[model samples]
Target chain A: MKVLVIGAAGMVGRKLVAALLAAGQINDKAISSLTLADVVEPSGLGIDIAHTVIATDLSEEGAAASLIAERPDMIFHLAAIVSGEAEADFEKGYRINLDGTRALLESIRLASQSEPYCPRLVFTSSIAVFGEPLPAVIGDEFQQTPLTSYGTQKAICELLLSDYSRRGFVDGVGIRLPTIAVRPGKPNKAASGFFSGIIREPLAGLEAVLPVADTVRHWFASPRAAVGFLLHGAAMDTAQLGSQRNLSMPGLAVTVGEQIAALERVAGPKAVALIRREPDAVIADMVAGWPKAFEAKRARSMGFVGDASFDEIIEIHIADELSGKVAL
Target chain B: MKVLVIGAAGMVGRKLVAALLAAGQINDKAISSLTLADVVEPSGLGIDIAHTVIATDLSEEGAAASLIAERPDMIFHLAAIVSGEAEADFEKGYRINLDGTRALLESIRLASQSEPYCPRLVFTSSIAVFGEPLPAVIGDEFQQTPLTSYGTQKAICELLLSDYSRRGFVDGVGIRLPTIAVRPGKPNKAASGFFSGIIREPLAGLEAVLPVADTVRHWFASPRAAVGFLLHGAAMDTAQLGSQRNLSMPGLAVTVGEQIAALERVAGPKAVALIRREPDAVIADMVAGWPKAFEAKRARSMGFVGDASFDEIIEIHIADELSGKVAL
Candidate 1:
């Protein structure tokens, strides 16, 4: 199966590529070729499959058309301006997140008009689609009223994905992933970066700042689980998704205190003590508006899985990112 | 206050224009000017206010920018391709319904960049935004999973409206109007056209076809009430609307049987007998998925009103459309 992964340079994108190469196949079909595209050329892949990497901006006119010219059997779209960046630069956010996604959908649609083509397009939506005034446990039927520009962009893309799928332009599946915890890399500037930092930094035997209160709770999944969601979404029967093409994937909902305890259990008190409690009201208010837990019955019923606990998430990070060995 | 109506030639748009002219002012401010636009030139309005009528396709490039150049203090955007038309022609549907609306919003946003220009943009959304597997009564926060392309377009526009408003690009308000009953003028080919035809034709001493069963229940509002909704939405304080600018307007929910009973009371047994049962499975299936009733507490709390009952709806039709007289 020929596959194309947009935004293939990002954290999840790189991991997903590795996972695909490791398996050597998807849905039991051998990977014949792969095409990777992003603003910056993706590197460090040691795959033997016929592959090509290109640096391109999908939002530019005709950019999406050029990408779809190859007509890959499956496309994984994970390109988006992160929340904080989108919120700061409104025009760039809408351009890259909203317009870019639309261009891609339109490209696929126009391509279908010329020939019999319906690619399995798996899009990565975000939990940011849900915002303040949320229910204690967000259900499958909760309304999407995103408070941030990034959230709004993702929400719009979800709507477009469903509409396009319903119209038979593309076979689309949107997975609203939880914040990836213990993200394996250097800490980024995202407000939710701390969710991973508190664990990843400690596991690496380094200091990490805890921005919010211990009572603060959030839904999480390891990067490994996120990649799993993409694979499952690519292979699943979209007929089961009905008219709503988007699904909020299952996640391990845990409090900061619970996360700390898990870290302590795994790496001893030294690792837990590395987390220093330092309050930042701006980040605190932003975190407070985020979803804590979700009743993702629809996604679960459809067989999409996640880490059962924070401990499992940490373990996955250690096994995958640290080669099953922590600094301690 | 200067006002601009994008769909001044349509049923509710004409009524809204009439209502505005009758009031001579909005929010106690004098109606200094009125700019009206539509696909076809609107005619036969004897208004003394400085007004201009133009036939324009909003989806065309530069059209929206031209309209916003005047920068009317209040803008009522009600332009759209109807449901059946949108379903039949996908490109035209997205072009006019989705792209057209976005064009208008973008024009306003760009204009604002040059100078401070946040106009009151009151948009006309529809109940079609909600589809099947619905609760007995849809609430203010029900998920929008539109089954039809028209509904999808409207739902997408609602998301864009909220996002633009939240970003301070435009002061926007979106009202999801229920099926406008007892519509004046010739019946169009819309499946839901029967809802108005069943009552309108009999009142005019003509036979009407009932395509769906009497047990089928749906939401309703008179053309007069729809006009009222626009006026109220325009003049009301939007400070309380928060980030979610779209509202499901209050409506009378009654079964087709109840509507028939009310018609019989308003006219006579002879008028009721004018209705002929003609089941069309296509329309019946479509109607089956429509919302029956809504718990529009948010709109009600904000002082938006609707007909109390089917009897009141019939009364409104007679008063507004039939010159306060029904053919007995």
Candidate 2:
């Protein structure tokens, strides 16, 4: 089966592609065609399979139509503006996140008119869809009242997913992913980057600043669990989803103190020693508004699993990232 | 105060205008203007107030901008395509519902940028925003999984309302109205028309068909109660609403058997004879998907009230419609 991965150069996108390749679920003997598209040309990941990497911007008028012409059986939609960037530039956020998604859906609709083929659309949503004044554990039935523009965009896309799926133009499933902890590589502009940087930088023997206090709690799922959610979402029976297509994925709820303790346990006290506590008033206020934990019963019932503890998350990061890399 | 009614020629629109006039809310002595806009010219309401009736199609470009240029202090957005019509015509539905609402909001935004005036926008949402397989009583926290195109449009509007309100662009409140029963007119193209028809026709000494079975339940509020909800919503302390601007108004949940019993009690057994039981499979299936009851705790807490029972609904209809024409 042919597969198309949009935003294929991003962190999770790269991991997802690697996981798919390692599984060898599509074809064993002959290499299956894989199309990876991103704004920047993906570089140096040892992708030796029959894959085509296209460097293209999807925001242009005809770009989406061109992308849909390939007619891949499965489409993983992971492209979006990060939370900080979206908040800073409102117009760009709406254009890239909202308009881009709409253009893609419309292109799929127009393409299907030629010959009917409803592909499995896997959309990566975020817990940012939930806003402030939240319950301790947000249920599946909780109303979507997003506080940020990024969250608003995701919530809107969730609605569109349901509508499009109901129309039968595409079999869409939106997974509201938790904040993926222990994110590898250099830190970007995400406001929530500190959640990962606290551990990742320390593991690299570099001092990492903790913006918020150790008391602040937030939900987390390891990158491994995130990839697992995507795979399970792709393999699951859509018949059970019915009209409600968007789901809040399962994850672990841990406070910052708990996270540090886990880091100390997995990476030794020397590694944890690289962490420095510095409270950022702006980030602390923002983090305070986010939901502490979510009741992802629906996702749990659908076979999504997450890290039992923050230590497990750190261990996954160790196995995946620091196994053969320049270790301290 | 100046008032602008977007769909002033519609049934509820006309009633709302009349009620406003009777209450003397529109200051007639000063520069207070009442702008009535519709696809067709309004006629024969016999009001001596300062009013202008304009026949303009809102779907046309620059229509919303021109409408907002007047800068009325109160905007009643009652314009929308009916459920069946929206389901039948996809393009028209999206064009009128989604595009029209956005156009109007953009126009308001443009107007506000030049001046510092934000109008009190009361948008009329519907119970169609909720989908099937609902709990026994759907609360304010129930996720919007719209089963129809019309509901999707309304849900989108609700999202926009919340975001715009949070941004302080407009003081907006979306009131999710329950199905109005005992409509005092001929049947419309809506699938739920039979709900009103069963009561209206029988009360008017004419035979009406009951499409669904007696056990079929539906959530309802009288047209008067709907108007009350709108009035209360318009004047309520929006500061209490915070980020969640839209609210589901309270209504009575009554089954068809209960309605018949109420009819029997009010107009005796003879009037109940006008209701001919004709089981329509299509309507029955449609009815099955609708919400039976709503737990409108938010609206109730905000001081919005409705008819307690179907008997009260029938009595109010009689007192409002046939007070002098057909004495009980």
Candidate 3:
């Protein structure tokens, strides 16, 4: 089985590529070739597989058609502009997120008309799909009323994916991933970036700003688990999904205080002390509307795994990104 | 205020046009001109209002831009291919329902850029947005996991409406209308046609087929009520909607048995005798996945009126379509 990974240059996409190459197969089907695509050509995808890396923008005319021309057996679409950028530049967000995904689906449909072609499509959605007036624990069936253009784009793509899949044009699974914690990278200015920075920076002996209070709760998963979700979405028995092709993946719900407690458990007081408290009301207000927790019963029943705790999420980050080492 | 009705030729559309002409205004604003657009020219529009009737398909390349060129102050976008047809023809369904609506939105946004222009965009969504695994009484926050392509299209439109409205590109309101009963028309092959047929045909002294069991329940409103929902959508204070611009319009939920009883009560047993049970499993299975009832607290609280009972729904048909006289 050949595999195509869009947004292969991004953190999760890169990890997914490495995992796919490490396994050398999906569901015991021998992987033959790979196509790695992004806005910039993906690099250093180890020499174990026959692969081609293409720098492509999906929303451009004929871009999706060209990408699907080779017809990979499984496709993982993870391309998106971050929420801050999408909200700031409305036109660009719709073009890249909404039009791009729709173009890919349309291209696949057109390709299928030539002969028979139905590939397994795994799309990465986000918990941003859920908005304010949320329940304490959002069950498997909460409405998707995204409050941002980025979230709206994801929700729209999920609908398109389900409709296209139901029509037999493709086999699609959309997994709404939690906010990945301990994201293995330097902190940027994203409001939610603090979720990862408060862990990653402190582990590196760097003081990280804590914008919200200790009681600010949110859903989280490790980057490793997010990649696992993509794989599971690729290989799962879609028959169990019935008509609803999209699902919110299981995740750990933790408050800032709980996260700090986990940090203390994992790396002691030194790492925990590195988090500097600096209240920013703007970020706090935005975070308040986010989904705090989810039941995710359907995804769990379908065999998708969740991290045991915030400590486990941190452990995975250290193992994968820091080579199991802490600066202290 | 100038008004444009995109589907002035459809069942509810024709009724809406008639009501608008009769009122000569909306929310006390003196109505000026009208633009009636559809796949075919809408004819016989009352000359009380100066109007332009255009035969236009919204999915066409420049149709939406042309429609919005004059920029009517309030637009009612009620055009769509029905459920069964959208399911049968995939491409056409996406073209007409999905792309057409998106085009209209994009056009409106572009028009706004030239000058300050934000129209009251009242879109007619359907309860088809909600599907099975449904609660006995679906609440305002129920997930929109539609089982069919038509429902999927409507749900997508609702998302776009909310997003666009939130962004200040348009002042939009989407009302998810219930299954309109006692339709004033000839019998049709649509799966849910029986919902209207049993009442419409019987009242006209004609035989009507009942495909599903008596216990099979569904949500409904009358032609008059459906038209009222549209008018209210156009005239209501959208600020009350907050970021959620869509709503499930209130309607009566009744079983087929209750419908027949209402028919008996309204036109006596002679009219009820005109109904014949055919027991179509295909239609039955399809109907099974449909939403039964909704709490509709949100729409109700917003001052949108609902049909009092199934008996009122039947009475509406007689008063409006039958000229207050049943043929029995």
Report the number of the highest-lDDT candidate.
Answer: 3
Q: Please give the lDDT score for candidate 1.
A: 0.92
Candidate 3, residues A4-45: lDDT per residue as tens digits? Answer: 999999999999999999989999998899999999989876
Tell me the spans in candidate 2 whose CA falls farther than 4 Å from its real position.
A26-31, A57-59, A324-328, B26-31, B323-328
Indicate the residue-level lDDT of B303 in model 3: 86
> Which candidate number has the best DockQ?
3
TM-score of chain A of each: 0.98, 0.95, 0.99
Evaluated at residue B174, the lDDT of candidate 3 is 96
DockQ of candidate 1, scored on C-alphas against the true complex (2 decimals): 0.76
Q: All candidates' lDDT scores? A: 0.92, 0.85, 0.93
Q: Which residue pairs clash within candidate 1?
A: none
In candidate 1, how many clashes are counted?
0
lDDT of 2 by residue, B3-120 (tens): 8888888878888878777776633323377898888887777878889998877788999988888788888888898788887876788788877887888788778888797888
Error of 1 at B309 (Å): 1.2
What's the candidate order when arranged by decreasing DockQ? 3, 1, 2
Q: What does DockQ give for each predicted structure?
A: 0.76, 0.71, 0.87
